[model samples]
Target chain A: MLDEQDKNVIRELQKGLPLVSRPFELIAGRLQMSETELIERVRSFERSGMIRRFGAAVRHHDLGYTANAMVVWDVPDGAVDEVGQSMAAFKEVTHCYQRPRHPGWPYNLFTVVHGRTRDECVQISEKISKKTNIANYRLLFSTAELKKSSMRYFE
Target chain B: MNLDDVDKKLLKLIQADLPLAPEPFREIAESLGIEEAEVIGRVFNMLEAGVIRRLGAIFDSRKIGYTGTLCALKVAVDRIDEVSAIVNSFPGVTHNYLREHTFNMWFTILAESKTKLDEILDTIRQSTGVEEIISLPAEKVFKIRVSFELD
Candidate 1:
């Protein structure tokens, strides 16, 4: 429903967001929209589900929770449901879902476990296996963080 | 989505900082020069519309004692639904993606501790028999958060 000009304005804002007091006001001034109009659109986008959520993307390193790891599951075809569902219930598990498989490695099911220390993560993983009773997975620990982004939408 | 003068004022305040106060509503209301109820009303509307998914801290896993990674798996075609249910069971994995490629099952997990993260991955491998799993962890976060211009 937005015209090209409106979209452009938002696009520009997306590129360079100010980290200051009254950030929106500064954006509004550049976009030439009354602060009110911009807020309306943002609110609308969020309501429509286009904008999932709005909040700070915290810095894990600064927070002192700096150990990260990824674990892959080779769940049985028939028992995927039971296993996946049970994995979703873990408190430490944050993002859990399925994807298509790759070659030479067919372990498709995946889940992430987090803890204050490596030992804690291991305990949760063990507990998950015990509860599900279906084991056959691999741990792919991240040696590097390639790209972390909060993609620009309007532009 | 009617934006009156007052609603504009309310939004400007929160856009700066989500209420971190005990009576966040009161502080926001005062800033907008409106009643506390008015500010809450606008927030409620946004939430109902899906504009606001949540009002909480978006933690950085790597910094917050979480050793997280993005792992892609080769899942069986017929077992997509079943696989989703199985994968969603873990809490560490908060976000994932569905891409079109050999390593199709693209997912992520945020683990609290390293040993536990390994264990979780092990569990998955034993369960799925995925062809190959590759992880691309973030090394340098070029840009992590989206800074939206409400205006």
Candidate 2:
């Protein structure tokens, strides 16, 4: 539902804000608007739930948290919500969601855990399993990150 | 680079919302009892060191009417590099990774509609000669927002 101006502002923002004392000042100037107007627009976007967050994208790998694993679990269809909520409550788990299960892939719940080592990640997953009481799971660790970038909504 | 106490504090501060004030960095400096110049300098250094991926607004993909799926492909080991290149060529493929599994390649592709997503996935399968791709689209999101606290 965003208009052209909103899209333009978002596109500019995805490129990243100017690292000046007043970042919005330059952004607003470029967008042909006042600083106050630009901030207001961003606030409205947040209010409308379009802008989920406006913050720093930290590089967890650089923060000494080297371990990362995507743990997928096969919870009963009826208990998916309960198990998913329980899994998401843990601090180590960052993203938890219920994804579709194909014929061969019975995993319905997926959670990403980060720690200092593989053992730490496994321990966290075990804790989640004990809490959720779902044992059918698998841990997939990324060997390489081929690409990681914000999806560009506009050219 | 090692992160000193100041850098850690700055990272935590900036990870939350940057104040909407005209002098937002100055506001952060005041909160941390540091000079505005020091905040700017540290942020610049962190960006160069890749500690901060970006400073921007994150939009809700679904709210924006874009659909996406997390796809796992059992690509031939020798063909992984080429298949990854083909997948990455599509603008919709935002994240492509090599994971430790029979389905070694995993990536998320987003498009304006379900049809477009299917078309792109089909093209990838044909080009890579991969028979099956386990496409796991998110049915329900229990949690997504997370911020790492650097202690």
Candidate 3:
């Protein structure tokens, strides 16, 4: 739970830190607080797990990572935890989750894999499959990115 | 933009976490054995080239009292544009993509509450007139870190 002041800090922080020597000082001035107070609040948020990460959001596509695939697997319900952890250990697997299975959608475990080429993505998926022994899976490659933006909470 | 060795090292460091201090970039520069101005210059170049989409805090949606879900919708080939436009109109929709599958359109949306999430989904369905929409909420998030090695 966040008070109004904390929310205000987050709203400004989300816009991004200024690329200056003393970015926090500039932000603190706008929020009507001291630089030390602003940094302390941000550190507290990170410690509390409210701020999951505080760093650069790199666009993988621009870094020559053009191949991206969402690999969905139908691991046995009893072995999902073990298999999901194994899948996540791969450096290529950026995101892994156990999503609810819908009607006609038997896949429960989802992993987003990225690579420099389509073949590289396939090879990584095969490696993951061999490691996890989850054969019932399909790869859904993204044809187009319609929208990709961070969530604006306070606005 | 071509990334030199220094740029690669800097990207990897900044991708993890910027130091929480009065002069955070200076700390990064000290560790990288470079001047603070050089570090700032590289970051600025990457931003200009669209390599770094943002440099800021990433909040945990659930921890922050928000609910989110991933949805996939099946649409006729000709109506893909119309259906996707309706789906992407909602501010809650953070990621919308056209994937290659029967359920061709996929997106992830976040809302303040479960009710609000469902209402947004319902409105998208009604507006698009697409009946085959499935929402797959995460039962367990095993991992969600996205870090790329530039080596």
Q: Which stretches of candidate 3 lie over 4 Å from their true place?
A: none
**Superposed Cα RMSD, model 3:** 1.0
Model 3: which docking level applies?
high
- Stretches of candidate 2 exceeding 4 Å from the true structure: none
Best by TM-score: 3
For candidate 3 chain B, the 10 contiguous residues with the lowest summed lDDT are B142-151
For candidate 1, the TM-score is 0.51
Report, for every candidate in turn, its global Cα lDDT versus the true structure. 0.57, 0.89, 0.93
With candidate 3 superimposed using the best TM-score fit, by how many Å does residue A71's alpha carbon deviate from the native? 0.1
Rank the models by DockQ, top first: 3, 2, 1
What does candidate 2's lDDT look like per residue over A10-121, in tens digits? Answer: 8888888788888999999999999999999988888888878887888898998998999989999999989989888888889999999888788999999999999999
Docking quality band of candidate 2, CAPRI definitions: high
Error of 2 at B4 (Å): 0.6
The per-candidate TM-score of the B chain, in the order shown, comes to: 0.81, 0.94, 0.97
Q: Which stretches of candidate 1 lie over 4 Å from their true place?
A: A1-6, A9-21, A153-155, B1-151
Interface C-alpha root-mean-square deviation of candidate 1:
14.2
Which 10-residue span in candidate 2 chain B carries the lowest summed lDDT? B142-151
Interface RMSD of 3: 0.9
- Comparing 2 and 3 on lDDT, the stronger one: 3
Per-candidate iRMSD: 14.2, 1.2, 0.9
Recovered share of real interface contacts in candidate 3: 0.91
